[model samples]
Target: MDRTYFVYMMASCRNGTLYVGMTNDLLRRAYEHREGLAPGFTAKYGLKLLVWFEQYETAHAAISAEKRIKRWRRRWKLELIEKLNPRWEDLYPGLVPGPA
Candidate 1:
Protein backbone atom coordinates (compact mmCIF):
# COMPACT_ATOMS: atom_id res chain seq x y z
CA MET A 1 0.00 0.00 0.00
CA ASP A 2 1.14 3.53 -0.72
CA ARG A 3 1.81 5.72 2.30
CA THR A 4 2.26 9.42 2.76
CA TYR A 5 5.47 10.80 4.14
CA PHE A 6 6.20 14.25 5.52
CA VAL A 7 9.23 16.45 5.72
CA TYR A 8 8.39 18.80 8.54
CA MET A 9 9.99 21.69 10.33
CA MET A 10 9.38 22.29 14.00
CA ALA A 11 10.30 25.38 15.95
CA SER A 12 10.47 26.64 19.46
CA CYS A 13 8.91 29.94 18.43
CA ARG A 14 8.72 32.27 15.46
CA ASN A 15 12.26 32.95 14.25
CA GLY A 16 13.44 30.78 17.07
CA THR A 17 15.34 27.48 17.09
CA LEU A 18 14.27 25.13 14.28
CA TYR A 19 14.37 21.40 13.59
CA VAL A 20 13.98 19.36 10.40
CA GLY A 21 12.57 15.86 10.49
CA MET A 22 10.78 13.27 8.35
CA THR A 23 8.00 10.88 9.34
CA ASN A 24 5.14 8.90 7.87
CA ASP A 25 2.77 10.13 10.54
CA LEU A 26 3.22 13.88 10.84
CA LEU A 27 0.40 14.37 13.32
CA ARG A 28 1.61 11.68 15.69
CA ARG A 29 5.24 12.75 15.45
CA ALA A 30 4.36 16.41 16.05
CA TYR A 31 2.23 15.39 18.99
CA GLU A 32 5.16 13.48 20.46
CA HIS A 33 7.40 16.50 20.16
CA ARG A 34 4.80 18.84 21.59
CA GLU A 35 4.35 16.61 24.60
CA GLY A 36 8.10 16.17 25.04
CA LEU A 37 7.60 12.42 24.74
CA ALA A 38 10.69 11.96 22.64
CA PRO A 39 14.01 12.82 24.20
CA GLY A 40 16.86 14.83 22.64
CA PHE A 41 17.18 18.18 20.87
CA THR A 42 13.50 19.07 20.45
CA ALA A 43 12.60 18.20 24.01
CA LYS A 44 15.70 19.87 25.34
CA TYR A 45 15.07 23.05 23.39
CA GLY A 46 11.30 22.96 23.56
CA LEU A 47 10.78 22.96 19.77
CA LYS A 48 7.11 22.11 19.60
CA LEU A 49 5.66 24.31 16.90
CA LEU A 50 4.98 22.63 13.56
CA VAL A 51 5.78 25.59 11.37
CA TRP A 52 6.10 23.97 7.96
CA PHE A 53 5.85 20.68 6.10
CA GLU A 54 5.99 19.13 2.66
CA GLN A 55 4.29 15.88 1.75
CA TYR A 56 5.86 13.15 -0.36
CA GLU A 57 4.65 9.91 -1.85
CA THR A 58 7.89 8.06 -1.15
CA ALA A 59 10.11 7.69 1.87
CA HIS A 60 13.24 8.27 -0.24
CA ALA A 61 12.07 11.69 -1.35
CA ALA A 62 10.99 12.68 2.12
CA ILE A 63 14.24 11.52 3.68
CA SER A 64 16.28 13.29 1.04
CA ALA A 65 14.39 16.50 1.64
CA GLU A 66 14.82 16.19 5.36
CA LYS A 67 18.57 15.70 5.10
CA ARG A 68 18.99 18.50 2.60
CA ILE A 69 16.94 20.89 4.67
CA LYS A 70 18.79 19.89 7.82
CA ARG A 71 22.01 20.98 6.12
CA TRP A 72 20.56 24.26 4.86
CA ARG A 73 21.89 27.55 6.20
CA ARG A 74 19.77 28.98 8.96
CA ARG A 75 18.86 31.98 6.82
CA TRP A 76 17.70 29.81 3.93
CA LYS A 77 15.67 27.65 6.24
CA LEU A 78 14.07 30.70 7.80
CA GLU A 79 13.20 32.01 4.37
CA LEU A 80 11.54 28.69 3.52
CA ILE A 81 9.38 28.86 6.61
CA GLU A 82 8.54 32.48 5.95
CA LYS A 83 7.54 31.74 2.36
CA LEU A 84 4.87 29.28 3.51
CA ASN A 85 4.14 30.62 6.96
CA PRO A 86 5.05 34.26 7.02
CA ARG A 87 3.88 34.63 10.59
CA TRP A 88 5.37 31.27 11.60
CA GLU A 89 2.13 30.26 13.23
CA ASP A 90 1.90 26.83 14.81
CA LEU A 91 0.50 24.47 12.18
CA TYR A 92 -0.07 21.65 14.64
CA PRO A 93 -3.66 22.68 15.28
CA GLY A 94 -4.58 22.21 11.65
CA LEU A 95 -2.98 18.75 11.56
CA VAL A 96 -4.77 17.45 14.62
CA PRO A 97 -6.24 13.99 13.99
CA GLY A 98 -9.79 14.85 14.98
CA PRO A 99 -12.03 17.59 16.37
CA ALA A 100 -10.15 20.25 18.22
Candidate 2:
Protein backbone atom coordinates (compact mmCIF):
# COMPACT_ATOMS: atom_id res chain seq x y z
CA MET A 1 0.00 0.00 0.00
CA ASP A 2 1.07 3.51 -0.70
CA ARG A 3 1.74 5.69 2.32
CA THR A 4 0.68 9.30 2.64
CA TYR A 5 2.36 12.15 4.47
CA PHE A 6 1.09 15.57 5.49
CA VAL A 7 2.33 18.99 6.35
CA TYR A 8 -0.08 20.75 8.68
CA MET A 9 -0.45 23.95 10.63
CA MET A 10 -2.35 24.42 13.87
CA ALA A 11 -3.23 27.52 15.85
CA SER A 12 -4.41 28.63 19.24
CA CYS A 13 -7.08 30.72 17.50
CA ARG A 14 -7.64 32.98 14.57
CA ASN A 15 -4.61 35.26 14.38
CA GLY A 16 -3.10 33.59 17.39
CA THR A 17 -0.08 31.32 17.96
CA LEU A 18 0.81 28.94 15.16
CA TYR A 19 2.48 25.54 15.01
CA VAL A 20 3.76 23.62 11.99
CA GLY A 21 4.30 19.89 11.78
CA MET A 22 4.35 16.86 9.51
CA THR A 23 2.72 13.49 10.04
CA ASN A 24 1.70 10.32 8.28
CA ASP A 25 -1.63 10.16 10.09
CA LEU A 26 -3.26 13.56 10.19
CA LEU A 27 -6.26 12.42 12.20
CA ARG A 28 -4.23 10.87 15.02
CA ARG A 29 -1.89 13.82 15.22
CA ALA A 30 -4.76 16.30 15.26
CA TYR A 31 -6.48 14.32 17.96
CA GLU A 32 -3.35 14.34 20.10
CA HIS A 33 -3.09 18.09 19.82
CA ARG A 34 -6.77 18.61 20.53
CA GLU A 35 -6.63 16.38 23.57
CA GLY A 36 -3.45 18.04 24.88
CA LEU A 37 -1.56 14.81 24.49
CA ALA A 38 1.26 16.15 22.36
CA PRO A 39 4.28 17.49 24.18
CA GLY A 40 6.39 20.61 23.63
CA PHE A 41 5.47 23.73 21.65
CA THR A 42 1.94 22.97 20.53
CA ALA A 43 0.74 21.72 23.90
CA LYS A 44 2.42 24.59 25.70
CA TYR A 45 0.84 27.16 23.40
CA GLY A 46 -2.55 25.51 23.04
CA LEU A 47 -2.30 25.26 19.28
CA LYS A 48 -4.99 22.67 18.75
CA LEU A 49 -6.99 24.00 15.85
CA LEU A 50 -6.00 22.60 12.50
CA VAL A 51 -5.78 25.62 10.22
CA TRP A 52 -4.04 24.26 7.14
CA PHE A 53 -2.53 21.14 5.59
CA GLU A 54 -1.10 19.66 2.42
CA GLN A 55 -0.62 16.02 1.53
CA TYR A 56 2.47 14.53 -0.06
CA GLU A 57 3.22 11.13 -1.51
CA THR A 58 6.60 11.06 0.16
CA ALA A 59 7.71 11.77 3.72
CA HIS A 60 10.69 13.67 2.41
CA ALA A 61 8.48 16.16 0.61
CA ALA A 62 6.20 16.57 3.61
CA ILE A 63 9.12 17.13 5.97
CA SER A 64 10.69 19.61 3.62
CA ALA A 65 7.43 21.51 3.27
CA GLU A 66 7.00 21.60 7.05
CA LYS A 67 10.54 22.84 7.64
CA ARG A 68 10.10 25.51 5.01
CA ILE A 69 6.81 26.70 6.46
CA LYS A 70 8.23 26.70 9.99
CA ARG A 71 10.80 29.24 8.87
CA TRP A 72 8.25 31.51 7.20
CA ARG A 73 7.43 34.91 8.59
CA ARG A 74 4.32 35.10 10.72
CA ARG A 75 2.58 37.18 8.10
CA TRP A 76 3.30 34.70 5.36
CA LYS A 77 2.11 31.82 7.52
CA LEU A 78 -1.12 33.61 8.32
CA GLU A 79 -1.66 34.40 4.69
CA LEU A 80 -1.13 30.77 3.75
CA ILE A 81 -3.66 29.64 6.32
CA GLU A 82 -6.18 32.27 5.27
CA LYS A 83 -5.82 31.27 1.66
CA LEU A 84 -7.06 27.78 2.44
CA ASN A 85 -9.00 28.21 5.70
CA PRO A 86 -10.24 31.76 5.79
CA ARG A 87 -12.28 31.19 8.93
CA TRP A 88 -9.45 29.23 10.63
CA GLU A 89 -11.75 26.43 11.62
CA ASP A 90 -10.66 23.39 13.61
CA LEU A 91 -10.41 20.75 10.91
CA TYR A 92 -10.23 17.78 13.26
CA PRO A 93 -13.89 16.86 12.93
CA GLY A 94 -13.66 16.40 9.19
CA LEU A 95 -10.63 14.18 9.57
CA VAL A 96 -12.28 11.82 12.04
CA PRO A 97 -13.56 8.50 10.74
CA GLY A 98 -17.34 8.18 10.64
CA PRO A 99 -19.21 5.73 12.82
CA ALA A 100 -19.75 2.37 11.23
TM-score of each: 0.96, 0.95
Cα lDDT tens digits for candidate 1, 2-51: 99999999999999999999999999999999999979999999999999
Return the top candidate by lDDT.
Answer: 1
Off by over 4 Å in 2: none
Every candidate's CA RMSD? 1.3, 0.9
| Cα TM-score of candidate 1 | 0.96
RMSD of 2: 0.9
lDDT string for model 2 (10-71, tens) is 89999999999999999999999989999899999999899899999999999899999989
Residue 49, model 1: Cα distance from true site in angstroms = 0.4
- Give lDDT: candidate 1, residue 54: 99
- Could you tally the backbone clashes for each prediction? 0, 0
Clashes by residue pair, model 2:
none
Number of clashes found in candidate 1? 0
Candidate 1 global lDDT: 0.95
Q: Point out where model 1 deviates above 4 Å.
A: 98-100
